[model samples]
Target chain A: MVLHIMADALFISVAILTIGSAIVALETRELVYGAIGLAISMMGIAGFFLLLDSPFVAMFQITVYVGAVAVLVIFTVMLVRTQALFSIKEDPRRKTAGIVLLLVFIGGIGAVVLASGLGNPAFTKFNKPAIDVATIGKQMVTYYAPVLVLLGLTLAASVIGALALARREDIEQKNERVD
Target chain B: MATVPEEFRFGNFLASIIWVILIVIVLLTLVILPLTFIVLFYVPLPPVNGEVLTPYLFLTMIVDPTRTLPIVKYLIHTTPFKVIVFPGFVFAAIIAAATIFVERKFLAKMQLRVGPLYAGVWGVGEGILQLAADGLKVISKEILIPSGADKPIFWAAPIAFVATAAAVVALIPVAPGWVVSNTDVGLIAVFAILGFFPLIALLFSWASNSKYPFIGGLRALHQMIAFEIPFILSALSVVILAGSLNLTHIATSQHPFWFILFLPISAFVFFISSLAELERVPFDLPEAESEIVAGWLTETSGMIYGLIQLGSYLKVYALAALFVILFLGGWSGPQIFPHQLGPPDAIPLVKVLTLQGLYNAVTVNAIFWFLVKTIVIIMLMLLPRGISPRIRIDILLHTGWYKLIVLAFVNMFVALALIYAGVLGPGGSLSIH
Candidate 1:
């Protein structure tokens, strides 16, 4: 019982950290600060995944989210023309609407949670053990093979679209010069 | 006689003494943590019987049967026993200082010049003492927080980096079960802790608010992506062959046929990726010391920077051990002495110590091999640092996305085909299972 309580405490602590930092990330005026907060939140999420007994997911979270995405976000933020990003402002009404929508969505989720039974340990007790590399690979190749292909295709399409966008921008610039 | 550090001068003499004592306490914590295992685990076990007892000890007795390794293994397991000896940090500090001096001495000799003969005995001890002197010097030096630097992040980054290194030592299975936390997910934990390194490094770079660190961090992020895919994929191959991600299981799987032979490509990929992970030569482009003054370390100074250096070495040691456990059959060597020397049931303690000893000895023996592997790779890293010119950033990005990514994808397919073709298998079944 004590162990369960401690686990629950740690899980809640991680969730709070993740959500708190994520809010700071989304709401922060400073773009660099947002990236930093996002990285911190991602780290918290990774720790939460560890509690969930999914080390593979935790590693993926660290590698992709914290390591890659955060870095890229910072990189883009650095590249932007404005150095003092904190001084910038967005439309207040749009921000208020976003907050309202978020609260309503969360309220709906809360309502659903209250309506359902959740304290069931049996739901988590599967005979199958933790997912290792082989099982994941086997599943990825055999059952979810099409999804992998789709992801690859999506990546390719995005790259092609980006190239096309750049080409069109170059053409427009040339036309402007000609005019 | 000497003035105390400003941070140390909280109030008066007593407070200064307390501050000094606290630093010593922290140093002791770093050194003595490794030794607790030997005292707690190996000493109290019952003696071994005449029957060679366990398979692990049996194997140790078989491999290198010359020395009574099963008996005297504790002495060599001192890598982890680093905690017990208060002077361990001193030795580390000394060794690091000596490394610089020794390299200089070798260089001077090449140029037909004598090294620092006046400092100590043939300048041998000079390098050893230089580290302490340098420590004293660096500590006294003014710490510069650059104009545009993000103050808190700049200060916290080195601490975070060093903390991750400290955390790794807790999980590294030094000899047998002589580990702080022998979790089932030991291998994954190793990488998880390692993953913190780049984040802190990038943080340090960004916090400095410098152009170089920004570029370094950007390059490091890209390099990490390039190498991490292959690293994890190759690690997955080992997991597939071993049937477990547990370090113990991975080690034990090397019994009949080592995983290296079965999945040579995986081993190659893993080693190269590890080299890249540590941001060492060939892949040490983030620092490319010539191009950028130590990359992310450009602004760092004093003992904090030394801690980062120490952390890097710790990472090196951990990665080497992980490589050994995963590929080079861990602690499963032969016992030197027979149980007839001291009857079966009377010596369970002896047997345990001997096995532990053999485990340590084999690991120590393999440390030489491990060092050889690491050194060769380090030399390879240093070669590019010295010899090769830097590739353009665009070229680096292109190679990562166009070549390495495709190669990793192909390697995954290769791994799958190899698994299907029973390359990582023994006869019919998957070997580890």
Candidate 2:
């Protein structure tokens, strides 16, 4: 009983941290801080995934979210000139409204949770774990495999199109230089 | 003077311990789940089934149903404690230290010279002793928060990165039934987690607020999107062939013939995609040290740098382990022992252990075979890293979008054709009416 309570508490805490950090990441004035917030938010989401009984998802959340996405945001921040940081606009009214709305939203969620505790709604359990790589492939090929193949073709077309678009510019630049 | 209140200190300390405990639980569960099956099947006289693959059938014979749950349950119950933390941390550190020693020596040998010959044990412990020394060194050194850097992000990044990589091992089955939580979405989970790595490095670079790191981050992001498509799609090929996503089933599916034998191109794509995803060698544009001054990690120091390196190496190992499972028959070895001796799983732990012993053997599994496979892939990656030299960004974009993407499509068709042609299994026959 005590363990379950602690688990629930930890889950709620991590969820709050994740959502709060995400908001901060999205809303912060300083780009660097916002990226940091994004990393924290990603970590929080990873924690939430852990509570969802999918440790793998949590790991992905951390690796891709904190490891990859946050880093990209930070990189973008660096690429833009520091002078731009000064020029960046901040909307105080919108910020205030966002915070107010966010607080109310959180409060409402808390109320709902309190009103109805987490109760297991019995769902048909799988004989084995599902959504593994092989199963996904099986389902894709047997059922949705064509869709995956179509997506692959579309991707190829787009790539070729991009290359062609890029090469045209190169040709135009060369023509200008030669002329 | 420390002005923080006593209660706050206690609370923080408690929280830290709790975090450690939680982490340990997750780790134990992940690492030991597969071993459970291996243990369960360690019992009696082997069966005589001519068609059954000797290793698994042998495993089934020896499987003592009585022993399966105890160890698994025990590990699960006790994992959430500090006791396990020390061992887990040590195991990771020891592997890291061993890799350093092996790499240094190997690099030296590759260059035709003795490496670290003067160190303790005449280079035997070359960097092994240095592992502890380095730990102390990192701890004592000042933690630098560069100008314009977000202090919290800089501090938290390494912890989050290392912790996630460590957590991934729980899903990886070392031996049969030795897993943490055998979730259905294991493959999706791995890919999803792996997808985040370059992004984290990008964040690190961005947090540094440096020029080169910024460029590196941008290149990484572009490469990430470029590579992720082929990587995920190729994995789909394996999934398609197997008709199941659960890793255990995936392994079991390969009992007749390894998936690679049936779909070699898919295997190749998966391997290459893994290399790119790991950001090693040719694909390691994000941290092209000579060009970008260590790219995303320009400003990191001491333990933080160590963590990044460790995480990167582990990623390589993780990828290789996945390859072994998905394509190469994981824990599936040619049977030398007679089947009449015992039941498959009930085969004494030693006999079963001997089959998987190379995989679980500390130096062998952790260093030799693991390192060899990863290094080969890394070498393949290196061939392109600087050997081919850096292409223009447009060229990089072109190759991925045009060449590799098209090749991946062709590869899929080949796989599909092969499957239909009865090359993959007995049932499928390509009939021309």
Measured against the true structure, the TM-scores of the candidates, in listed sequence, are 0.69, 0.65
lDDT of 1 at B63: 64
Worst 10-residue lDDT window, candidate 1 chain B: B84-93
The sequence of per-residue lDDT tens digits that candidate 2 reaches over residues A1-179 is: 99879988998899789789877877677777777777777778777777666665576666566656666666667556656556757789988998899899999998897677544344333345423344444677788978999999999999999988777677789999999
Residue B248's lDDT within candidate 1 is 72
Reference-based lDDT, residue A103, model 2: 100
Candidate with maximal lDDT? 1
Supply the global lDDT for candidate 1: 0.66
Index of the highest-TM-score prediction: 1
Classified by CAPRI criteria, candidate 1 counts as acceptable
Span of ten consecutive residues with least summed lDDT in model 2 chain A? A123-132
